[model samples]
Target: MTSPVPSVDLRLVDLLRHDLTAADFTVPGVEAVVGPTAAAALHREQDVPARRAVAAVLRAVADPAAVLTALWVLGEDVTRRQVDAALPGLGADGAVALGLVEASGQGADDAVRAAVDLRPYAAQDAVGEVTWWLASDLSELQTGRRLAADHVLGAGGASLTLAQVTMRDPRGRVLDLGTGCGIQALHAARHAGSVVATDISRRALAFAAFNAALDQPDAVTALDLREGSMLEPVTGERFDLVVSNPPFVITPRTGAAGGGASGLPDYEYRDGGRAGDDLVRDLVVGLGEVLEPGGVAQLLGNWEHRRGEPWTERVGSWLDAAGLDGWVVQREVLDPAEYAETWLRDGGSTSDRDPAVWADAYGAWLDDFASRDVEAVGFGIVTLRRPDPAAAPAGRVTLRRLEEHTGSVRQPLGAHLAAVLAAHDRLQGLDDDALAAQRLVVAPDVTEERYLTPGAADPNVVLLRQGDGLGRAVHASTSLAALTGASDGELTVGQITGAIAALFDVSATDLAAELLPAVRGLVTDGFLLLPQ
Candidate 1:
């Protein structure tokens, strides 16, 4: 039976009609009250009369569907009725003082705040409302939230990572592949003259368009939202920048939503269909053609590590196959068992429901891996730039780990790119004296360390490490130990060699001869940053 829709609160509608402005929500002391009180209220057993009154007002609406629609518009979900029940009486303005509307007007940053100290229910509602308000201004807020419920919103971690790692050079046109909520496209529009956003789901595309309007209305003219897979929608169109967070999960055909060969329609966000991580492979493979010469692409994905092949080698092989100059970072890795469980639950499957189905689903995943000789699965981001054939660029690939967990605005990704681009050619031929004459500086938060083997005559090994950012090896070398050690930013190669020869009891001429090649090697590799 189609359940009769319930009624909504006219008071809520009235409040919405006269929305409060951001400046009006900065009441002093109100924040403290709202945080604790709202929390307390959400967990309480007793339903306060004021809260009940608000619930009564909501239930009075003639069409519950309309109420749900309005609530969603207000940046909330109808599925959470308990939250609606506590909305009215619990806010930052003290108990029974004001509702969210009135309190917000009194300078509460959040729509809902705690009315009492340590009130659990109110506090819970406060947290939820805080999240709801973040994406509230965004038109794609509701759809993105609905699609990934209870997950935090806004230009968050994954979003910001893509933004920072995105290719920022001026381009003819940019394409935001799988433009979830139009975030990548919106960011890209700032750099590109034209931007096209593509997604498989019409609903996702709609949200993308709406978000683009809210965030970048003027750029809206240059932005195009298309509904289709990877490059399918814009088959003939090539782009300078292509960014995507495609559906990269690899799972079996049954008991999973929108994955496997037959289930593309069920889950548009992360299901890549074919078993054993085919979606990521397809995306990686196709990028070669979709990108224009000298174009760049950034993608966040997961890939499996089979038994026989190292994960780094496996990914490198793909880049090799695609025939591109790529720098890849494999941030984290998880075993099949742990990886399976995390994603299974993430897809909204409860282990308790249908034990046989859960077991079978998991078994299929393991078997799929076994068949492919897979050992562990890796999750990371890949940035690729198609080489300009005329430039005759070597297809260089780098695989490494990221040390930092959170995003920082101070990162020098731009400088890193600049450094790589500057040193694209071989740095091997410079004589030690010539190399030393060039002023060199290490990247920010980077240092060189020397290590020696115990009881061995072999010279010390030189290693480079970063203080922050990706904090990985610049390069390691035992043969070039003196060259790096002499990089105290004080002496030229001839000067350092003269000193090193004296200290190590070697001839000055021989030391310079030996160290020159090593210093040249350092420059040839990316260990030392050369002056322009």
Candidate 2:
């Protein structure tokens, strides 16, 4: 498989970066060239509006970003002169030298075609806000064809999800596994002192290196790029943090290479070249070998929902083998047919495009699921932490949380996840009595809603809803509601629970024991906050 990934030349990359900066090729810059509606339409994979908008801009003036948008983002070919004007610093020559664009013909009036998809990227994370450019292989959207077997991905949905959910605390060493295009590695570099990014595809590593050079010119040396599958490149090494958006996509193994109709190409960016769900399970189980004690690893995965079996048991079995504090949040569930359609469409092998191939591939997906009695597939974020040996509960995995929440949640969830981890550790350090003695306050984003019969004084139902961080809606018992409502940071939990117990004619100690666990949950869920 011959894949043409971008080459890395620091000098040329620097010149290109300079040209991009001067041309105002940025998130805001792109939006300015194309109106908001057009910019927003691209998210839906509809580029007609954007093409028309940029064409309108070009008709008025040779706006650098507008020209760049048409050629680079919309996948349109342009005259060499337009490329020169748009990137005055690097000009057409430098872009061609960098393998970003190529000359269409030998004539002086020859056109220039984008060899890679280069676009401005912007995101606000725990480290801070960043605006950088990412270069990856042209997608089916640009090529107007099916993706190549070794497609290097840009910042897609999974990449962004893993980035937003990653814990961003400063660390000594970090590893980005299967780092296609190095987007996660770049985000990690903002906080990690050093990053070792590895991928099974050298083309991916090439793109990763190029992206690193373009975005972090001074810190280009900070990223050590390696090429190997999963943890093989970092064997016998321990990292304080490990992040991955691995090639966990479950694909039918039709051949030795997992390719060429039910012949789905083994997309290096997604397919792990393994059997169903086993790749993800093995990756989770093997992570303990590479993580330092108390180190954290966050990644996204898909698990099978088999018939006559619960999803929790399926995923929990992996956590038990990992021997780490594991938390799995199943975010989405798709039926077998839907799953087939989603992945087929993702690889640009849709029914309309290729009905025969789509039918073959779609039937293969259904048969593949039926083999394992898989009724559906659940996708979500997975966070694992290796327990420190020195801790009291050293010998076993003390934390195991498997929950499902398929709803809107806050983005840039790094801080929230970090805070919740801290809260869990703090709670673990305290006993029931210690927890009761602590003062707690309701989070400002939290609200209470009560439903009652017509003109009834007492409510029929009480709901304590979190406005952020999974947006949990807890069914608060009358006592629990009273406890949170009176939690104004003045009264200790012991005092408040005692008062409520007396008013309800219940034993104080029993009430404290009952509410203490609930209190701990609230603290972890961001419904209640510990005093600063």
Candidate 3:
């Protein structure tokens, strides 16, 4: 008879780091192996309770003090006493109480140790300045499962996206919702006067606090770590800037990502939930109330689009409903089936054996969208500026499309805002009389060239280059070319045309009709720059 394949819960392997890191063992290759030795090493590395037990297991094979020194080098936080506390022979109830293993029946430490032994290779590099761990087995599917409370999330495109688009010059206050390891908050605090970071899980919050402390100790002091669902604990509080990389996974959870039996809500850091991307919708809408007037809110989000509906229109409508001036830019779009499979792997679904199950999951995703008439999906960075309703006309919302994506961050974005506001001020102040009298301002690089065919007394055509707005060069009548050439700060269109009439020995009246249009064209097309 054929043997039944064993089903191993992938989430246990995911949480090994949290348990091991807690114990202070420097697991070098948790992502490299499978089975008990890896798990035992992970348990020894992560759990304070597993320290002595893990040490006992290792001492049976390796040097005891050398292992202790390696553990200290990995994390000074772990102590020898803490390792001793995890030693076995303490009682069946005690091992379970100490959290060394899953307390299912009696002594499960052996199983726990076996899992730890499966952890990645733990070793110091040559200089010993930094410790490294491999994640060869940390697949996209594994990442989708519940991440540990102290899960050291691997770097990915999403994290880089958030880093590129987040506001760098924060004012009064800032908040990082779902602050994973406090990366968002850390970046925000460099500019924000005050920062508040919150996560649904305490362990996640603690990790955020630790990372913040390690990087920016003083700013860490200013960070108020709160445990609650998105913005719940901070009701009525507003900020100059609010940033988030919420759990946006569109998957169901099998308990928590961290190992062991913990009741924490599996707030998948990247999941948008199964609610048709409503998680992002609610977050944007919530910021409308939470943002101070003239303040800006930035987010990285994904949206589902129904057939026959323009995605831009749908996203723009959301901003309009929120009563905010938003600049929504859609960066990319994806098809239905491909999107489903990508996320299935992310959610850690071990459906490799069941091709039918994979098809079913894809079918479910399609049906969910089809029922709602969603045809395509979009993901992008959204920037919104809450309007001060009482402010001037220049402060209205604007939406623009970016030409391309540049991986390098645009730091000091304040200059761009200043330029935008300056343009707004200049355009809003234009009166009809000023518009009628607007003069063309020419640049130094502009010149007029006259061309004539074979031996003619008068030039047949006049060419204007660098004088027109942008980089356009055009052929014009001599009268038009003369009008443009005279626009150097020395004279206005009226004066320049009058001089041209005298030079060409033509009537001023005729010149006015011919050159006036060309001068107006130059100013309108921005061939010439006006005084600022």
Candidate 4:
């Protein structure tokens, strides 16, 4: 049976925190001790090199930090002496009392084994950088088996992605839906006056509560922890910001994936026990009800793409039904077979290790996709905002954008995204005439690249590239390039257009008509900014 989540006791947790801090078991500390090669290997879940590295470190010196890394991170057993020395404040007894470890025997000779996975996590956002020790259920590395359905996850790639993308602007109230291990809630608590973290699984809540208490006791103690799936727990309440990394993984409904003898394991951490991608669809459409006017909801999700229908149409339909301003960035699209293999391997089933089970699971996934005529699966980040009824255009939700951006993007995109939304609002209120009268400046992060053939008199192609934000690259026409080159905040857009039209011997009215739309695009995408 799976071990119970770590017990949450304030005083005991404080002692653990002291030990963790004193040992310097932070991200940099761990990286420094393990070095680059082992650290990289650990990320790949290959423990051999990391174990060897930790062993080498221990041999050279009896380092408490190395001992802790070996014991907690590498999932290796530590002697009682090492545990007592490393966590002198929380001793072996205190660790056992806190349910963080199990002591096998009495005295210094006894071996101590970690009952949970604890590691230091460091992150930077709009506010600043923070370091916290996160504790969750031991992974397959420790247990050497597939994770239990109710396993609570620690900081993974998805969690970090959601954290980096989340808007860190201070708000009155925040909601973290599906708060697995409460990572988002912790980040939300940094800026939000108050936070409510809800999850469907009690085990997950327990882990979240423990992690909160362990890291930000004062800040998270006031965090409202509720048990319910999705928005049910926070019904009727509203928030300024809502963030979720929901269980949006698509899974086959039946046990055919397990050779019909045992069906697909519905891991609560990743699967919502719903058919297809209905959970994501429902959340997108329903989450707006709990948002205050002008509130924003950021979430990560997966959507199915049926044959003959573009992914934009499918996701766009969700935004249409949502009745809110939304921007969907399709970060990746995988074919049915690739999607099946990726998720199957995630569940610890591999074709090389178990061909029969792999084949069965693969077939089940393909069959499910066939039933829905799903040709591909798309995954992306979703940002939704409830338009303030007073400020929004009458009877219209104007911000509905579904675009593909699979390339790299700047980290801590909160400021850029908030600016983009504000820019959109400003542009929506301006007519072409009003816009042309406004002065514009090219953003500092933007640069123009001229692509010219060898020995060419002039560049045939010009590209405007943004070094930050979405890392957008916009193709520029000769006239457009000249117009941007002249936009130095000293002249109105109309003035620049007139000058460009004179140089090209074209009508000023036609030039504005051609450049205004592109100018609007540039402003909306952060390539250009209105003068302050």
lDDT scores of the candidates, listed in order: 0.53, 0.89, 0.53, 0.89
Model 1: C-alpha RMSD to truth?
10.5
lDDT of 1 by residue, 1-532 (tens): 1111111233432232223212122112222222444324522412243243334445764233222222432233232232233232322232223222112343333343221111000111100111111111222322222223212123434665566555466778888887765667766777789988888766566545545543454677898878887779888778887888776777655543324432112345656566777788778878978888777778888888887677777777777778777767666678988877876664444523666656665676666667788788888778777777555535334222222233233342433443444464334324445565766654445577766688867536667765543444544544355556556566666676677778778798876666666555445334556765
User: What residue runs in model 1 are displaced by over 4 Å at the alpha carbon?
Assistant: 1-157, 254-266, 351-357, 393-418, 425-437, 448-463, 473-499, 507-527
Instruction: Name the lDDT of candidate 2.
Output: 0.89
Model 1 weakest 10-residue run by lDDT: 118-127
The reply for model 2, stretches above 4 Å from the true place, is 1-3, 105-108, 255-258
**For model 2, how does the per-residue alpha-carbon lDDT over 1-532 read when each residue is reduced to its tens digit?**
3446778878888889998999999999999998899989998898999999998999999899998999889889888888888888787888888899888765646899989999999987766788999999987888887788888999998898889889999999999999999999999998999999999888899999999999988788999999898899999999999999998888878632247534668788999877889999999999999999999999999999999999999999999999899999999999999988788888877624657777788888888888899999999999999998776365557789999999998888888888888888778778888888889999998999999999999999999998877788999889999999999999999999999999999999998888998999999888888888
Task: Choose 1 or 3, whichever is better by TM-score.
Answer: 1
Error of 3 at 465 (Å): 18
Task: Give the Cα error of residue 520 in candidate 2, in Å.
Answer: 1.5
Spell out the clash pairs found in candidate 2.
none
Q: Which clashing pairs does model 4 show?
A: 255-263
lDDT score of residue 441 within candidate 3: 65
Output the TM-score of candidate 3: 0.55
Ranking by TM-score: 4, 2, 1, 3
lDDT tens readout by residue for model 3, 1-532:
1111111222332243343444343443222122345445543333333444445545464432323322322222223333333332233233233222232333332222110111222221111222322221122222223333334343345654565455455378988888765666666777778889888766556555545543455565788889888879689989888777777654333322211142223334665444677777787777888888877777778787788877777776677767776655566677876776676555444434556555565566666667678787777777767766455454565433222232332333333333343343344445433433455566564677777788898888776665321234667887776666666665656677778889989997777776655554454434454565
Give the Å error, residue 487, model 1: 4.1
